[model samples]
Target: MRFVLAIVAFVVAVVLVGLGIAQRTVFHESAKNNLTVELDQANPFVVVGPDALTAHPGTQTVSVSGSADVYVAYGRTADMNAWLGDVPRTLVSYNKDKDRLTTAGTAGVYATRSPSPAPQRKDGSATDAPSTAAPTASVAPAATSAPGTSVANVPSPVGSDLWLNELTGQQLVTTTLSLTSGISLLISGNGGSVMPSKLTLSWPVDSRTPLAGPFILGGIIMFVAGLVLLLVGFLHFRRSRGPRRGRPRGLRGLLHVPPRPAKDVTSTGEARSGRRRRVAVSVSALLLLSGCSPDYWPSPASTEPAIETPDATAPVADPAASAAPKPGDLQVEPAVTVPQMERIMQRVSEFAATVDSSRDAKAAEQRFTGPALANRVANYTIRGTLTSQPAPPPIPASPLTLTLPQQVTDWPRAVLTIAKDSAAPTVAPMALVLVQDSPRTNYRIEYTMSLAPDAQVPEVAPASIGAAPISPEFKGLVLPTGQVGAAYADILTSGDASKWYNSFHTGGDQLVQQLGVEGQNTVRSGLPKTASIEFTTRVTANPILALATNNAGALVALALQQEETVTPNDGGTTGFQTGAVAAALSGFTGKSSKGVQRVTSIQLLFYVPSVSTTSAKVRLLGWSESLIGASELK
Candidate 1:
């Protein structure tokens, strides 16, 4: 029984030692995980929507692998082009107050004018008064050693890093990404997109290296000691049996004593050796088991990696910088020192000047957003197709706005109605509306309207404090804000045909003469008398906005289309080369050269107003309309 137990212990120890080696080798191997994300862009920014990943615990080497392609947004291709032409320089200061950069012991370089060097006087004495001269920023700085002067020899703020803006996408991209702590592996800069882009992310996972060399070594030692115990224990049991002796079999035999009791000894004393063999083997087996100590086993790994101290003999980490931008950096809201309107105008000027509006008008994007951007693009394209020399409307000499400060609210907003008399009758002033949604976002042009002479504008809060955007549902106005757009739409749809026709005044704003039935009949009146004319005008289905007025009235903006089609009883076609209609319908050839001319007039400039007073008719404040599309159906 003892022999069997000893052999079993030795086998178990050997298996345990093998297991230790395998655990040390396999446990240290790294692991990998794959991640994929779809990204959306809001211009100059890309946001990742999927949840962030958590790497496994322990030291691990992580690597990210993937490919992505990004495209310029609708109007943004021009901004990129401008960047290629004359890239804007970055301006950075040590702090938010640009004026606070202390330099070279001088108060600053902002003196109105440099004092002319004191004139040399007789007797080698200088004049007390400074010489007069025109102001020049380029003047060389005075020597600090001069009387009443104290200055340091440092570079000016302009010469320092304060005036440089880095235009690279790399820093922005890397700074935008983040990872969980204590994860091992190579990670590269991973961030930013061109908008509506697809991205793939991959990294190694499941890597753990908690156990140390000592731990593995300890485990092996334990197994070896167990084996030794088993071998000795079995040998002693066999010796006690008093079997034949004299060099037992192989290694096992070497451990064996004579297989005879002490009283029955051979002349060579082999019998006595067997008698003591049981005690000797038992002692040896005990010592072997004790030899397997915890010191040989590996220790548990530390939590986070510590910055290692420099050592004379240890290999050091590479000095290369982690080029990624620091994750989660916060930026203060930028303040606009210039009026928001001016800021918008500057952007507009820059865009109109630099952008290739005919080919790729991306510069206009900064000054426009939403519908405004769309309209500009469409208009540019149409003008190019219709006229031999299409010129974008010149920016007016001065800004035409009601309030100096503009409206203020959660989203600061401004409405600019710019107009000028032109030799060209079809030309009208444009109403540009700018909106700033957040502190960080620049004010973008949201909506625009063209105005006619009779159009009236409602009173609004000053720019010092902007008006709050009212809900269409608000009932403060005699007409609910929401119903204002619909009401205007209704009037256009029915004209005299509407049951509420009495609610509108045709003669008051001359709207009736133009939009009423008479106006429709007059246009086709010029068409062949034999041709039947049909006029269909209705408010566009697009959203009508009612901005709240200080007087409880609503500044309503509405858009609609007016179409007049003429069909001739005689087989005569309306020629394209004719009257004022030709210029108006330039964009549309309608059934080209056919007698049936389908003139589709699309007028979009929807701003109008409704008063808060009860029983008051909707007011025709001024409005501007454009021939957005003129098509001739074949």
Candidate 2:
């Protein structure tokens, strides 16, 4: 019995040890190694550099004047191309003697630049560049010795490079990427009060280590031991019910009392009873051994996995009903069907025929949302002019009638057909197609109408064209890393900067204060209009940090002159107001408010660095506006 129990205990311990090893993956292996990165929080750009170079677009080359042995880190060419200003530019024109960097895609070399002194080569050969034009001028950095500036590149594990943005004030250890190379590159650098003497490149390290004394592992062992012992006790009881096989037949016969006559039945009964007692004693011994055995137990179960229920929140079709078809799918399983569409057109045509001139304009207003409806109110004019209204307008439809491809199952779609009034010079037909993705549904409706001279049609949402919908890109403005600064640019050009400044309104003052207070430190000494703002020195709010601190994130910034305008120029007012400037500024709170009032166009740039690898970033940008004038009228 003791031997059997011991064997069971050994098997249980082995199974549990295997389980513990599998659970080790949950810890982060890089916990011992610190990594820092600097990010342009305002835009999706991170400059990982100092010694590394990345693949360039169209053989685009970057010359470094500040650091020796500068490395460039390059991402995939296709992704880099998507960057607004990172498009491959022809550096030199083989044909035109005028061969500096230009938009034309042609081959060329730097007119005055030196090739890399220690460039890494793919073929394992070192080579010097043929003499070109004079080497590009080098900027002498401040003479202060930089301590521990050695940088190195640790090739990220394939498919493991993470995209990171800056958080708040923590030092960044970043890998700088430059596109000087023809292909992708990566350069790693350190951060803090000082840089590192040598960079240690690490692959994804194993996160788990043996716990102190392996307490958890030990506890697990004991639990398994107890469970095995319990199970063995039960098994031993079953075996004990059978007879002991080792007792020989001859010994049993010798020990057994001879069968007695009827007069000796009592003695025979007593002998049988004694044998039964011995059997009971043997069973008890087995139970005791099994109960104390350590090998029969198994580890206890861990936390239960979460169970999922049907998500009532989602829009689901009833199991008992037919599913709704999507527009992209072909409902008429055969070829394309124009008859159904034609029937809809007929109904529209009939409706148009009955429209009376007096009632048509009113009816159109009912269906229009904003400017479209406004056009009908005044014959499409801002003033109350009804003159020059178009006769019958042309019908609207897609340039091509599309058929659903076989690959689609249930595509969502909607169609609206509009007819023209024959009495009013045969108004054109109009068609509107709608695609449903709920709040992001795509709508396309086109119609030509005699509109006000100033009226311009708004573009359809990006989702309508089967693309991701991003907010409108700000015009005539560029972000720190060259992205179209959208929302922040609008705030800079909000037309009421002076008014907001004069009254110290929270929104307007926020911009002004950020520019004068926060922005002042970020600037190196150049006036706002003269120096190109160095993006490296600026910082903004760290959204996650704000949540951790103030419980909210707010935008603050530097403003651009080009974005702020008093009146609309070639660019429309875009929601910004235009008004005359009031010269009499009675009260001013901040020193920045005392400046002379003027109108101009500008944009805002904002960003912040990180605290931990996991912290949020702060950001800032410029604001621009124009002074009101007589020429600016609603």
Candidate 3:
């Protein structure tokens, strides 16, 4: 019974220790975030978060686990996204800065990004967003103190990241990320076509917990319990030995001396020898079982499937799964990188500089087409005539945004919304349009117009994930992008009598009140009865841009030109010739020629619905007007 009791206690101790250790093994692995990246030789990476990236509270080392086959690189994610995605493959040429390149085979790819802006309150004050650092949380801001200073600011981390790509079919990847200020993961795809899909990040619940305390404590407790039982068993054997010290214990007392029957002498000496031998064998077995080894039970071997035990010499190639949210009208991935955007923006800026210059008008000419072309030419003509000094290149304001990809088909289109700083004190920022026809073609500046003071830029997804482009003919709002111009034109030509008139703002009415037949009334009432004036306005071209907003609406910018022509009777009555008349009649003088052709170019920005279910009415946010040409004779 004593031996049996000792075995039970030892077994219990072994189990407790094994359970505690098993729990510890379960949590050794940390968390991760994964996503697919389409490959492009020109731009080959999808930048992840530069959000919170501190190591687990108790973890000694935070290492990103990945493979060499897919390749990797790293860099510090900076607050400035200046040349973000445009880093050349061999960056040494473009950048000779101290920031070293993070290449594969040495340091793996990892990065950090600037934190998001805090939300603002109704009173125009800023407020904090929710926290994003607890386990399983999405990316969010984290506070950090500069080295040697105690002030905490949300600055960009210093470190680069890596890209993973494949040659044949898509490659399934599992990359372990390192612990630092934060990181952004970059990945490329096969042939710039077959890209990664989605990512699943798995890790222990509490990544900070190191070797769990319960397991170690259980092990210690069991060791002590085991030793106590072993000593007790041995002591009992010592204390119980006085009586049957010389006699065999006989295999746990199973073998006993029966009262020697009276006929013991009758038994052969050979039989007695055999009995004695069997007894000796049993006693020897018991002693052997109870020696140096504890006989109660053996400590349980680990039943855990496997553990990610830290090993410096051979880093484990942790496998990451692949898949992503299916692309739809809205995608969380960008169509271009920061570098690509910078290039696009540069071209537009250069083109804008060319606007006030005659040296390279063709470059700007190629970019401006349709109404935009007319607007640019008219601006040049007007500015040449109106300004006393050489016009400066239009400078863009801070906080420019690139509308993410909106078109879903192979022919995806996006809009680059630039807020041009205009000299006109009341003028709102100018919005520019950029369009790319295909993957290989470069994005071209298609149009530019002013946003109204009261208008807010439509909310769109981040540059990483693009917004869906609304079609010109989309009927989701009160009107379609294509129809707004015609409708507004009809309203302008006929005034409130038009049915679609109320669906729009009172800008048309205001323009009418300002330039209506009453202006002609001046010529009608002021001029002789035989001579009269007529005013005609026409929509010169299609809407230049139709950018999608998050509310299933669009911000459409269009061009409208209104021409006022005057005529004289056979009596030949003379009328006032404004400088407009002088400019139009510069080299010609005739009494009966069309009195004067006055041209006023109008650029209008309107908010129209791009989706079908919204009941929101169309509103005109802002507009810009210019007398492009006022000729003497029509």
Candidate 4:
């Protein structure tokens, strides 16, 4: 019973506290005057407060000056809201500066003061509203100050805060105060020495409004009574169950029933003997069924299935299975011959010299089968006539050919043909390498072209015979390379360590580490400067680049423009531009992840000082979409 009462009291307390919080936020004080008094059109409200407002508990009188408004107690209730309710407030005192309103009251109040004589109205009639002009100064007696300060003198600045109306420049003095529970005041003051800008008296609203004190007192009284009653009942129960003066010991012993009985024989022995025998038989039965009884026994087997097995011998079927052999299976037919690859390379070289599309080379590349061929195809990038210079050796008797479902064109490729074996051939692993482009390597392009020469060149010239001849305004190229050391110095001076570190973390870190390892391994393998190198390539173009990629179909093809010249007269002028399609994708290998789209189109001008004259714009013009088909680029 006591536990049950405790739970009820706990729940009541929790609910009361929750209601209090909700009430605090939703309920507010309602004032009596609102904007009418707070923002009067005729006269502004002014305020005055204790000289030492921050002083510890001491009697202080606040005064209001210069207004004609009466104050009253603006009582606040739960029903009143901030927006719709009346402002509840009461003024405490006024200042004759002579301390005329010095009487203390239990509550603050608002007192009205008669306004000074009104000025003539604009329509030739007198009115209560103060004129837009400044108020006429009255020669009033000075106020008396506390102790050391004189009544006629201005007090120290610390204890007083003043607020002035922006338009009128009338001052208002503010002071702080706390109020009692369930009671809040919002009073406006008026009279002498009161500043119009600081006429406010507000208090925090009571969070909870419970039943009247009498009801709560009654409830608490009832709860105490109930607790007392409960204690009395418990005492009575104990007394009733207490030892009885006439109770027999033998009966008490029988109630307890120890395992062994006393040696002395007593009355009812026969009855006790019979009870003992029955108890023994019950114990014997419990022991006998211990293992079989549910409480002491193991659970039965579960009803769910114990195992599942798949059909290993089932036949699998796919229509494309015949088109391309699996990686491990080498039973597919051949495509291109060893001699054909050599011939392709030779043709590509000639095409590269002419800067023409190697579309046929891309077509022949797709006929390869097996993993080795696929691996080689995946790693190949921008394989064109220029890449064909270092031609590969003759293919083995059974060259590998990769068989992909997708078609590719206008790209020179390396085709490998896997041998006729049931097992797939493993391609040799390539060494890791990393290439760095420092600020020292930074290059910028600036082009200035003039009309081409009037003299015509022979058709045999590589640049003249293909497509169109160089523009007449083809001025020689000029490249100005800056010192890498100076670029490093610039980086240090720019305070860009964080940006550089972020770039390193992204992918450059791994690339650099891999490059370090490759360099070490190459030296260990007796290959010094001739170590296998991997290039990290980046392609960038003008803001017009965004237009080309997004509006490729709309852009019309233009004629090629080429030129050759030495270094130009500018900072890092080793960059040039030519109209051409650019396409590239990184991180492609035989062990590449599946389910990734790997193809894209690129149209960009290629520029490199080592490859050709950096000052010249070597234009390789073509539609990237036409050159690199919509096949995957991975």
Candidate 5:
């Protein structure tokens, strides 16, 4: 019976071990789920919707091929569609029930138009020349193109500031992301007429077998038990078969018989050695199995049932969901997302660096506009003559401290951002105002001002929930946005005597202290006795940008032109100092019969508190000054 039990145990152990090993090797499922789609219809741009990316519950790996240069970008779905505009594109979505990706073609006509001309300076010189080539439309080709039809020309989406992230590769591109709803991917072929022809998406899947380890461990235990049982059975048999001394025939017989057998020393020694070997083998097997990972073993399932109280009956409402506009309601998206703004700032920083190094006014104009462009172009011109002139403060790319985008869904969008340079800690942070005139055009920096050390930025809507653009005539503030520049100009001219002087806070205002009436009087005191000086300050023609803050006030940005003229009082003429900025800009080598005039462009950013606020004042946040123009008095 013992032998039979031992044999059965050994058989059971072998079967269990074999089954466990087989489960892990032959019965394991694929570690990842992969799906490949081949395009039957060619399109200029292919958009992969969020549904396809989030179909599985893990990070998605997307791969594209069949193009010389593959380009991929992901951003907000609304932004992608807005960029597409009237242009058509192929939309790819996932059908969970069908377990496959489906593509639909949007039908639309492709049209090209000339880009708007760049703004001109006061001297009628074009700040930047517009591209003569017609802008290529990024539209989708017909679902089934007619025979002999050439591919449609498609503009590449590379380097667009709208994208939160972008990737590109030669012939193939692969990226992994864990996407959420309302986010999408755009794929193209690096400005080629045709997009990539193939796409592969993969997601990881769990393939571990919980029972493998338990079964193997159990088998090892049973094998050890079987070996012990077999050893015991064998010993019993040996004892039974051995010549035994008959206790009855007695004591004398026992001693004589045992001695005659010679004790079978070799068999006894062999048995003892075999027992030790079996014990060692069992211990080795246990140690080997013990080192395996817990993932191989079966996990204990919870025995407690889920219990719900009255409080748990209702699901918690998501704040974002609650705040979202209801169906059929107008939903206005921000001009740009936070990540998109960051990318734009980085590009702007790079462009600024390039322009600064080369002193290229034309190149600077491409990324700058209005007062910002004027200042940069003037600086470049001054540097051309006066190489020692300091360049404008650098626009850092990283550590975007604040972002305020306009809440609108139309052309001519604006966003304000404050960025600091980690590499240059001593340099003050810069506040930039960027504008996008149309879907086809990239954002350009309109105003760049270095923030004051003690400047305080008011609370505003989050980047996700952008603030509304206030009109010039908005009365919610202590003063109208349109009049802010003129008011500040008055304060600069009349000092405490100006009626509007008290409306602003001049403490810590560097511009005010440097260009105010007191400062101008000081300049007059230094001039030649025969020379007379006059100062005139007025708002420029540049449009003012005002974005609403959370406190019902508005953050305003405007430009003022300050003219300083020095004329000889007694029919004599005066000239600028030898190395003055005015001399360099005017190109006047020596004293001129006519007086010299210098025009300084000042860009100011202010925060005006609402009328309801107590003891409110217009606070200066940032400012920039540049000698934009200088000439001999006409």
Candidate 6:
């Protein structure tokens, strides 16, 4: 009976082990799920929507082929659609039911009208309409046509500042991305003339088998037990067959030492050996079981009913409570995302560094405009002659302290950012006002000012929910944005006598201390008796940009031109001091027979509180001055 049971256990062990091995081999599933799509009609560009990239709940592996050079980029869905305006493209999506990829031809709309006002729900949250309404037939030109006439000639998506991240390769490209909702990918070929014809997306799958380990481990245990049982049974059979000793047993019982039954040494040795075998089997079973983890075996169903415990910190539902506001409600998307702005800042910093090292004023124009560009060019020129003169402060890229972007959906947009240099602790932080004129152009620094050491920045909307652009004539503030520059200039010139002096906060104003009535008197007192000086300031034609703050105030930026003229008191000739910056800019060699004039360009940034606020005042946050022009009076 023991032998029969041992054989049965052996048979069951063999079956279990074989089944476990098979489950790990032939029965295993693939590690990844792959879906490929081949376009029937090639367009100049392809857009992979966010839904398709996030079809599976893991990282997506994207591959593209059938083009000499393949380029892939991912950005906010809205930005991708905006860049594709009026351009023909193909849309790629996943069909979950069919477990395959689908493609449709689409064309973006190019609206000529201004962007509509942001829509608001009853709860005061904001929402935006979809940019692309529906799918349209492919409008890619059949053959090569005039460049401007064909929609196929759209600008290459390669180097566009809109992309958050991008990948490129020759002939074929593959990349892995872990993206979230509202982010999308765009694919195109070099020169925007050809599009990749094939695209593949793959995601990893879980392939662990729970029962394999348990089955193998159980089989090992049974095999060892069967061996022990077989050994014991064989030993018992040997003892039973030992010497047919009925008579010997009787004699040994009378005189147990008659022959000692040959001492039954073999029986004792066999018994000890059987015990050793059982011990070995037990040890082997323990080792095999110890190697396994919980995942190796199936989880057992609980027999006891689970108790429900109330969490002490969990909030109780209130019948009168208002529902939480939805994301993106009352919030318009900024002109650029935070990551996008960082990249732009990096690029601008690199270019500025090159320009600074080379003193390339012409090259600076590419990244600067208006007063910023004029100031940089003037500095470069001054440094060319005055080699000992220090260059303008460098623009740092990293560690952006504040970023306020304009909420708009049109060609022109603006952003305000404050950047600080970690390497130069003595240098003050710089406030930059950047503007983008159109989609094709990069953002330019329109105004750059050094913030006051003790300046306190007002609260503003977050980067995700950008602030609205305020008009120069906006009346919500105590002072109109358009008149801020002129008002401040009056305070600087007339001091307490100026009509607008009380409207500004002058307690901690460095510009007023250095360029106000007191400073002007000091300069006049030092002038030679033969020369008379006059000071005049006027607002320039540069556009004023103002953005709303959270306190119903506005942050305003404007430029002013201040001129200083010096002439002989009694027809005596007067000239600038030796080696002066004004002399370099004006190309004056000696005393001027007429008179010498110096024009200083001032960029001012002010925060004006709303009229509704008590004791409202306009505070100067930052300012920059450059001797942009100087010449001999005609």
**TM-score of each predicted structure versus truth:** 0.40, 0.20, 0.44, 0.15, 0.81, 0.78
Q: lDDT by residue for model 6 over 485-550, one digit each (tens)?
A: 888888878999999999999997888887788778888899999998888877776666677788
Model 4 TM-score, all chains together? 0.15
The sequence of per-residue lDDT tens digits that candidate 5 reaches over residues 1-634 is: 7788899889988988888888788988888898788753355678888898778866778899987878888887766776665545778889899899988877434333222222223222223443323122232221333322344434446666677788889889987776667778888777665568888888878766888887887778778788878989998998889556545555664564435344687788889899898889867877587437765776764222212101101111222121333466445657777767777888888889999889887777668888899888888888888989999888899899998887654556788888999899898898888877655567888888899999989998788777766655556679877678888999999998999988999877778889998789989899989998899999876666777788788888878899998888767878888887878887886776778899998988899899999999999999988899988877
lDDT of 3 by residue, 199-229 (tens): 2333233232333344444555555556567
Predict model 4's lDDT versus the native. 0.24
Ten contiguous residues with the weakest lDDT in model 3: 313-322
Structure candidate 6, residue pairs in collision = 125-329, 125-330, 126-329, 126-330
Task: Please give the distance, in angstroms, between residue 510's alpha carbon in candidate 2 and its true position after superposition.
Answer: 31
Please give the TM-score that candidate 2 achieves against the real structure: 0.20
Whole-model alpha-carbon lDDT for candidate 5:
0.75
Between prediction 4 and prediction 6, the one with superior TM-score is 6
Q: Any runs in candidate 1 off by more than 4 Å, and if so which? A: 1-338, 349-393, 403-430, 435-447, 450-458, 489-497, 567-575, 578-615
Tens-digit lDDT track of model 1 for 271-329: 55775687577656745653454423445643555222111111111111112213453
Q: lDDT tens digits, residues 16-69, model 2?
A: 444444434343243322222222121112232312221111122222211122
Clashes of each: 41, 99, 43, 64, 0, 4
Off by over 4 Å in 4: 1-215, 242-634
lDDT (C-alpha) at residue 195 in model 5: 61
